[model samples]
Target: MSLLDEVKNELAAITDDSSLAKQAQVSTMLRFGGGIQLVKNVPVVFAKLTNRSSAAWLKSSIMEIWGYDVELRKASSTLATGETMEYDLVAVTREGKRLALQCGLLDQRSHEITGIAPAHIQGNIAQVKAAWRGAFLAKGRLSDPGKSSMMEIVCPSVDSVNDLIMAARRLGVTAKPHRVNSSVRVRITDPDVIERMLILMGAHTTAREWSGKRVEGETRGKANRLANFDDANMRRSAKAAVEASQKVRHAFEVLGEDIPENLRAAGQLRLDHGDASLEELGRLADPPITKDAIAGRIRRLLQLATKVEKQRAANAEKN
Candidate 1:
């Protein structure tokens, strides 16, 4: 299942007080999907929602909360995959000149609904969690943990988006608001914050699953980085050993028994143990010398090799 579906299913499994759940459901719908519209010159209050199940839940909650049996219907559209997807538009009617006035969608100066405003969002953690859950149910999308950390909720009403930001802060999740063309988005990016939100939304199992995947991905990344570092180090050491062997062979061919014993020992150790690190070569020295001491001997051997090559070139020219 998609991460968004997993979160919604997990939320569906949560059991909470009936009244609080209804309040939260109403709050979410109003902010994200609820609208005041004119139908046949009659005022109609409706929630145009995407998820059919969530729309059904909203319809039921509206009946229980306000004694209204709203009409529910499918608004279908063709997808890019040529699959049909239905949007549930739950609408209710009441006698009023303006639909916004009838649905309490007007500014607070004219209308205010209990349990749906920002003031109602404070002082109760359970109620606040439910409210955010409600808003998320309307328009939430969570990215897969295996890919990235992102959780977002979109609301058509700017006031509702503000309500969401406050409610999230009350739950200790830092949510930022931004405008996306006609809609506003409350986005969260921190993995820790996203996990906390899942837990608050009553998706404990999904949160745990996401955490496990995040940990495993991080562990695998570190292992790959370490392996690459070791491989690069080995290649560099092997290259240095090859160059040291060539210098040592030149020193011996020209100096023979006259070669300094210290230089000769360092060169022979490197030529025999081409894959060994400089530290390991130091340990293999007859006197068990330090890496710096072995390195100086190799330097001297290179210098002697260069002089021997120069002398041979001079002799051949004279001949």
Candidate 2:
């Protein structure tokens, strides 16, 4: 199963500590996952849940906590879902109105409450967490931690987009809103935030596994970078060695026996060990020296050769 399915299963299995929290969860789920309507002048609240467990949980929560009977039905697959049918939980009762009031979906006078509702359905942290859990169970999806660390949710409305952002903020994780066509999306890209949110939603085991996956990904990335860096360094060293051999040969042609004894020895060592590193070349010298000391002698030898070559060019021009 997908990581999202795991989280949803875990969320659907959660047990609420209070009826108020359950009510908040139910209200949020109904608002985001389905529609609240008046069918034949009677209040009807329904949710379309992708996960079977989530659908069962919503239906049972309404029945057991709110004392409302919900009919769970199989919904036809849409083209957008690629023929994956979902479950529908339809609850028709006056209690739907009460749940809407608590969630600020409707006012005391039975009017629709538009825009983002005031945060925290019951002004309690548990209510906020449960409400967020409900929204996630309804619409949230997470990418595999081994591939990418991101969570995205389709909000029912612009109001819900902000509601989700506020809810996430209350939990100390930042969620950004994005608009794609007519739908609003809440995106959480930070791996830390995704892990923390999963934990807050009561998916502790999934969160831990996700954390391990993230760390493994980072470690693998770092090792690849180090290996690439070493490859680049080796390429540079090989190029430098070839270039030094050419310059040392040029010195022998231009400055010949005129080269200083110490400098000539350095140039000869470079010519003999065409593929050796500066440290190895230093050790191969008759009088062993440091890499830096041998390198200095070679630099002087090349400079002397360049000076003579420049003078020879000037003499040829004059002649």
Candidate 3:
């Protein structure tokens, strides 16, 4: 079975064992699979396994696989806001390097209904950020000699990486971006980086998810409204409306001063046919004017018209 399958099987076995839960809130052990392994209990669940799970399992497993001594500690505290928080597992590698892992699962069904998949991912990132900050502040007590400490965020989906980066930015932290397989990942080596990555990621992910759902809903609504109209009539009405506006603007420019031949032709077409667009104007011209060229000429003409109107107003004021 795959690593994911193994994790699921182990989680099922552990959850079913009431003895394991009573002995320790969390458990850590090594299991042999495709290779030697270390498995730690991760409690957060969304719809899918997240970065926290990967980090928790990978860190512990790798340490054992490499024959490094590992220690797991439980840390919990209440924030100034009176919010209670807990750390699932804090592992110290034999090299004395400290690593913190937070795991969460996002349910696909809820994501589909609430359309907050991104927000859910951001929440996971927030927990990781909190754990990192908590660790850094306690570094005086947590740090060990000859060991550099770092935090790793693991999520099942790569979609959350951008959110994590946003969180780092908000906290004024410099976060290093990395990848864990196909998933998007960010690494925090600095305390400030950890703070910022978490905040930015959380905020951005929330905003992006909200915006995406809003846009999709708006688009669908618009399509429904337009569905009632006859396509040919809508197209004609749209074309006519555009041509009428363009013709008036073009006429003002033509009356102002010397106009180029190509521009003159375009203006005439707009004035004569109330349904012609820039594309149609382009097709009619000799050595046809490109759509961009037509647009540029129109813009310049409007600017000139504005200047002429301004001059006329100034002259009238003087009189």
TM-score of 3: 0.26
On a 0 to 100 scale, what is the lDDT of residue 154 in model 3? 43
lDDT of 1 by residue, 1-319 (tens): 5767777767755646457555755656655675555678776677766776677777777776667667889887797799987778777776322434433455446453422455347637777887788778878888776567788987766667777888888887789997777767899988889889989888899889888888788788889999999999889878877887887787778777877877888888978887777788899887798888888998888798788779989999999
| Candidate 2 structure quality by residue, lDDT tens digits, 42-109 | 77777788888888888888778756667888776666747666565556466667767765678678
lDDT of 3 by residue, 1-319 (tens): 3322232223322222222121111111110001111344332211111223423543444344344454444456687799876543434333321111211112333221111123322444444343232212121011111124344544223433455455445455665667755644456665333324323323333223334444566677678668766676778778765865675565565465566665566566556655666777667667787767766666666566666678889999999
TM-scores for all predictions: 0.75, 0.81, 0.26
Off by over 4 Å in 1: 18-21, 39-52, 70-104, 107-116, 122-124, 178-183, 243-258, 307-319
lDDT scores in order = 0.74, 0.81, 0.40
How does residue 88 of candidate 2 score in lDDT? Answer: 58
| Candidate 3 wrongly placed segments (more than 4 Å) | 1-250, 253-257
Count steric clashes of candidate 3: 26
Better of 1 and 3 by TM-score: 1
lDDT for position 228 in model 2: 100
Error of 2 at 77 (Å): 6.7
